[model samples]
Structure formats: C-alpha cells, structure tokens
Target: MYRKILITTDGSAVSQHTACAGVKFAQQMGAEVLALFVAPDYQYPVYVEIIPPSYPSEEEYVAQMRRLGEEYMGKIMRSCAGANLQHACMTAFSDTAALKIVDVAEQEGCDLIFMGSHGRSGWGQLLLGSVTNKVLSHTTKPVLVHRLISEPASG
Candidate 1:
C-alpha cells in the first residue's frame, strides 16, 4: 500500500540489481519512486591529507563527486524510463549514509525504503558497518533490503 517508495543506489552491481526490484515493485504498485545516492562530502575530508600528487581543490572535489552522482543516478533513471515508472532522483553529501537516507525518506514522505544490502557478517560487519542495519535501527518507516549475492546458487 505504498504510495511513494524511496530507493537508494550506488551504481554498483549490487545496487543496480536492487534497483531492478525496486522499479518492478513500483511499477506494479503504481507508486512513485525517489532514487537517492548519498555521496561523500568532498568539501570536507576526514582523513589526514598528505597532498599526494596534486590533491584536488575543494571545488574540483565537489565537481567530481557531482559527476559521479550524475552517472550513478543515470542508471536508475534509465531503469525507471524503461519501465515507464514515475520517478525522481536526488543526491546528498554525507559520510553517514543511514542519516541521509532516513532524512530523505522522511522529507519526501515516502511510505517505504528499498536499498541493496551486501549482507556483511561478523568481523567485516563490525569493521565496515552495515548501512542497511543503521537505517533499520534509525528509521521509523519500513525498509525493504535486497541482499545481493556474489554468485548464483548451485542448485
């Protein structure tokens, strides 16, 4: 019964796979999709800079991030276009994906959130942190996570 669905993508194979499901679901439900790509804040670098081989200027970094965002958004846009689904795209700067994702879903009044999940476990999960888990913990809305498999199952 979702009228609006928020889908997050990174242009990765996993996210691309996840996007297909989101688009198909939206098409079936007649729901509007909002595709979001949370990108790194190029204006601010958390890591120490050694200035290795001419580091890009703040403006340059911002522009680069924007270009990447555009390319990533393009994938979802094309999928939506092919499916003839009503959709829009958005990009935001954040090191914390969960915060930005949840914020956008709330702001856009989306009834559901769909994101591609890597399904990390144990040590890797602890070290890298799962964005899906973070969003699940923080958001009040329902989230549908599509776990991307590295390989097809051997029947």
Candidate 2:
C-alpha cells in the first residue's frame, strides 16, 4: 500500500540484497522507488607545509564523492528498470547517514524505507553504531530491514 518507497544503498552486498527485495515489493505495490546514496562529507587534512592536498581543494574532494554517488545510483537505477519499476536516484553528502536518511524520507514523503543491516550484535553493534538502527529509531514511516546471511570464509 505504499505510494513511494525509499531505498538506501552504499554499494555493499547487504544493501544490494535489501534493494533486490525492495524492488520486488515496490513493483508489487505499483509504487515509485527512490534510490538514495549518501556520501560521506569530505574533510581536508590540516596542512603541515602546504604541500596541497591530493584532491587540491575542498571543491575537488566534494566533486569526487558526488561522482561516486552518481555511479552507485546508476547501478541501482538499472536494477529498478529491469524490474519494470519507475524510479528516481538521488545523492547527498552527510556526516551521519542515518540522520540524513531519516530526514530525506520525511522530506520526500516516502511511505516506506527499505534498507540493509550489517547484522552487528552486542559489542559490535555498540561500537559500530548501526545506521539502520538509528534510522529505525528516528523515522516515523514504515522501515523494512534486510540483513544478508554471513557466509563462511573460503579456505
């Protein structure tokens, strides 16, 4: 019964897994998908001798992250198209992805949020501070969290 479904991706396996299901769900509901990729904000290192940062300037660094966002968004858009689902892609820079994701979902009037969880627990969860958990805590809209099953390491 969702009109708009927002899916967040970070090019991780878990995120992609979540997206695959999200697309199917959206398709079934005839809902439009909003594929959003949030890039981390770039921070320039303090100059020791003004050797010029590798990116040269803050503008260049931001541009690079934006490019990465676009690339990831394009990949998701292709999958959405394959499912015959109408979708749009968006990119944003934020220090905290969870907060930004929740804010975007509210601002865009999305009915549901589908995202992947890293499936961290106990000390891991406490130390890493899950984005999905934070988003769940903040958002008022429906959120579906998908976690990929961990596979045993190859010998």
Candidate 3:
C-alpha cells in the first residue's frame, strides 16, 4: 500500500543490512525508495577562544562527510539495483538526524519510514538516546523499525 518508502542508514553493518531488506520490501510493494544518509554537522570546539590546529575546517569536514555518505549510500544503491527497484539516494548534514529524516520523508512524500534500531534497553538506552526513538516520538507517519537480531553462535 506504500507508494514510497524512505530507508535510512548510518553506514553501520546492522543499518546496511536493514536498508537492503527495506529495498526488497519496497520492491515487493511496487514502491519507489529513497535512501538517506545523515552525516553529523561540524561542531566547533567550545570554551576555546582560538580554534584548535588539529580541528578540521568546515570545508574539510563537509568533504569528509560527503565521502562517508557516498560510501554508505553505495551499498543501498547496489541493493536497489539487485532488487530492480526504483530508488534514489541523498545525503544530508545535520546533527539532529531524527529531525532531518522526518523532514526528508515529508518532503519526498514517503508514506513509510524503514530504519534499523540497535534495540538497546534499560540504562543503555537511556544513556545513549536513540534516533529511532526520537523519530518515533516526533513523526506522525508510520515507521517500520527493524531490530537487529544477533545470529546464533555456531557450536
């Protein structure tokens, strides 16, 4: 029933795997897919009047993040190609990834958001805020969260 699906990735193995699955799902539904990678924006060091020599300039940071985004988007591209699915990919620089994801989905007119979650619980989840959780909290659209399940160890 989904006309378009937005699949997000962070370049992690779990997210990559989830993105591939999302592509296949989109294919099955005859829906177009938009793969998005959100890179963190450059942050200037605080409390220091003078910028540190070791810190990268804004141009350098953007170039580095663009390279990383391409690397991550490449995997999604291959998956879409293999699935024979209609797909497009983009990269955005935003420290608030959840907000960016929601905005992109809305702007692209995507009916579904498919993404991976580490599935942390208890204190861990509390300590490290989850983008998936934030997206869920913020968005009114339907979200399909794929929790990465560890494979059983071979004896």
Candidate 4:
C-alpha cells in the first residue's frame, strides 16, 4: 500500500485522464497525493545573435509555462477534492522531465509514482524518447504507468 503517491501530468488529454485515475487510486489506498507538473525550461536560440523578434524572453516563457501548469494542475486539484483525498500540487521548471519526476518523488518520500505513457513505439519512440521509459530505467521507486488506449481506425 502506498502512503504517498506522486501523480505527474504534462497537460495532455491522456495525462489528464491518467491523473484523474491516479487520484482515484490514491483515494482507494487512503494515500496522500502530490500532483506534479513539469514544464520545459526556456531554451535559448542556437544563434543568440540572431534572436527572433517573436521569441519569448526567459521571464515571459516562465510566466506562460506557469500559467499552463496551473491550468493542468487545476484539473488534478478538482479530482482530488471530489475524491476527498489529501493532496498537494506543485509545478517544476525542468527540461529533463523524467529526472525531475524521479527526484521529486524521492525528495517527497512518495511510495509510488503514477504517470501516463503515450505508447509510442519503434522508430517513433526511438526518435522521441519517452519520459515514462526513462523514469522506469532511472528510478528504483515503484511506477504505475497508465497507457492511453487508442481506438482502432475505421476502415
């Protein structure tokens, strides 16, 4: 039984669904939930000398990302409230989301991590590295990955 659960979200529809489910799972286990949103760090242009006019400043980027995190975390908050589960939420700025998630889980003493996997495979997965996969590889803590089921294409 998990005493504390770490639920991670990236604001995607699948992640939102998984977060809600994770909240429900925590409620069932009578565990406290720590909802986390990891926003990508602001990246500098490769050609610093030729910065694009529309490019956001670091401050502007952080502010925007924070707002987005709030929106995403808000859903988890509502779910926790509805479930009457003890919970807290935070947003972290980190490009390495997998590392950040593992670090937060350890730092917070979470017994379990609940997160969503997009289920990409083969070349797609290789080209676009999976955060869930990385978390699985790097962390010794228990991770429950909720994979989104895709509907079969209509002929």
Candidate 5:
C-alpha cells in the first residue's frame, strides 16, 4: 500500500540486512525507496576531545561526515540494484538522527520507514538508546526495525 518507502542505513552489516528486507518489501508493494543517512552533527566542542582539532577544522569534519554518509547511503542503493527497485539517496546533519529520519520521511512523503535497530556504531543499542525507539515514539508512520541479535542491557 506504500508508494514511497524510506530506508535509513549506515553501511553496517545490520544496515545492509535491514535494506534487504526493505528492498523486498518495497518490490512486493510496488513502492520506490528513499535511502537516507543523517550524519550526526560533529561540530560540538565535545568532539574536540574525541578528534584532533589540527587534523580537520570543525567545518571540514562536518563536511567529511556528510560525504561519508552519502557514500554509505549510495552503497545501500547499489546493493539493492539486483532487485531493480527505483530509489534515491539523501544526507542531512542532525544530532538527533531519529528525529531527522522522521523529518525526511515526512518531507519525502514516504508511507513507511525501514531501518536497522542500530547502525554501525552500535552505541545506540549499547545505551538502550536506539534510534528506532526514538522514531517510533515521535512519528505516526509505519517503521520496520531490523535487530541484529537479542542482548540484555549492559551497564
């Protein structure tokens, strides 16, 4: 019943797995896919401690993140080529990635969202702070979350 589906990815194994499910679902439903990757804003002062300030300027770091996001999103699209599904990719900056995904879904007029329960970083799940949970709480759209495994929370 969906005409447009939005799938979020981060080039992780779980993301690829999620994309596969999304692709099959989209194919069966006759829907086009919009693959999106929202790079978390990396300009905060906190990042100075995480990364060397001399390596890249704050602006350059954000740009690099966006570029990597696009490349990862593109990889997702390429992987779906065998399915012959119509698709597009987008990249945005947001510290709140779940909210950004929902925003993009609305902007793209997508009927459904498909994404991994956690991206490559795995920090989301590690902290019981899954992006899927945030999106589920914030949006009315249908979401399919792909989980890599069943694990108890670790403090």
Candidate 6:
C-alpha cells in the first residue's frame, strides 16, 4: 500500500531496529526509503581568549554534530544490504527533528513513516515526550510505531 517510506533515525538501538523492519516493509511493498538524521542544535558561548568560556560556540559544536551525523548515516547506508531498496540520508543541524521528518516525507512524497517508540511511561514520558509521539500528533501521513523493548510478562 505504501509507495514511499520515511524513516527517521537518531542512531539509537530502537531506531536501528525499526530501520531493519522498515527495510523489510519497503522491500515487500516495492517502495523507496528516505532515511534522515537530525543534528540537534547544541549551542555554546563565545570566547575571545585562549582560555575559552564554559560553553563552546554553537557553530563549531553544530558542525561537529553534523560530521558525526554524516558518519552515522554512512554506516547506515553501508549496513543496508540485499534489500535492494533505494534510500537516501539527510542531516539538518538546526531544525526540529520531528518537523524535519515531516518535511522530508512531504518533499519525497512519502505515504508511510516507520519509527520506533521508546515507550516511556509515567513521569518520564510526561517530562521527555518522544519524537514518535510528536510525529504521530502532527503528521497527516500513516505512521507505524514499533516498540523496541518487549514488555515484562504479567502474573
């Protein structure tokens, strides 16, 4: 049913697990995949002398993050073998990752999004809302959220 799929990765285990699943889904549906990695804006304070301030410049930190992101994306691309799915990776340093996912999907004409949920609960979930939650709440496209960690058995 899906012609194009968008998969967002933060280089987490759950994200990688979901990526594997997405590759399978894309293969089954004969769809292309667009994988994205967002470099969060890690800002630092500016300094004049050799003894720098507590925080580094936002520009330098962001560049470092972007380089790391690119390396991670390279690994992701190299890992996808035998699926024969057409895929591309993108890195956006300053943008909100959730929104970037949506924007890429729209730009690529994606019909489906495959992502992983950490399944945070109670206070944790409340305090640190997940990207999956945001994407689900905001997007008009169909999303499949995979729970990476299996739940404990009940009595």
RMSD, model 1, all Cα superposed? Answer: 4.0
lDDT (tens digit, per residue) of candidate 2 on 1-155: 89999998876544566677788889899999999888778766666466553545668867877787777677678878998888998888888989999999999989999887652345544422478888989888889887657722322
Off by over 4 Å in 1: 43-53, 119-129, 149-155
Better of 4 and 6 by TM-score: 4
| Residue 120 error, candidate 3, Å | 10
Q: How accurate locally, in lDDT, is each candidate? A: 0.79, 0.77, 0.83, 0.84, 0.77, 0.69
Score every model by TM-score.
Answer: 0.81, 0.83, 0.85, 0.85, 0.79, 0.75
lDDT of 5: 0.77
**lDDT (tens digit, per residue) of candidate 1 on 1-155:** 99999998765655666787888988898898899888877654445565554678777887787788778778778888888888899878888988899999999999999986652244534422378889999999999887655632322
Q: Candidate 2: where are CA atoms >4 Å away?
A: 48-53, 119-129, 150-155
lDDT winner, 1 or 2: 1
> What tens digits encode model 3's per-residue C-alpha lDDT throughout 46-108?
955888898888999999988888898898888888888888898898888899999999999
In the predicted model 1, the residue pairs found to clash are none
Candidate closer to the true structure by TM-score (higher is better), 2 or 6 = 2
Q: Write the per-residue lDDT of candidate 4 for residues 1-155, one digit (tens) a residue.
A: 89999999876666677888899899999999999988888899999999999999999998998888889899898888888888989889887888999999999999999987752345533422478889999999999987657622322
Residue 103 CA error for candidate 2 (Å)? 0.7
- Look at candidate 2 and tell me the lDDT of residue 136: 87
- Report how far residue 38 has shifted in candidate 2, in Å: 1.1
Q: What is the lDDT of residue 108 in candidate 1?
A: 95
Candidates 5 and 6 compared: the better one by TM-score is 5
lDDT of 1 at 129: 39
Best by lDDT, which number? 4
- What tens digits encode model 6's per-residue C-alpha lDDT throughout 2-57? 98888777765545666777778888998887777777677443434553664557
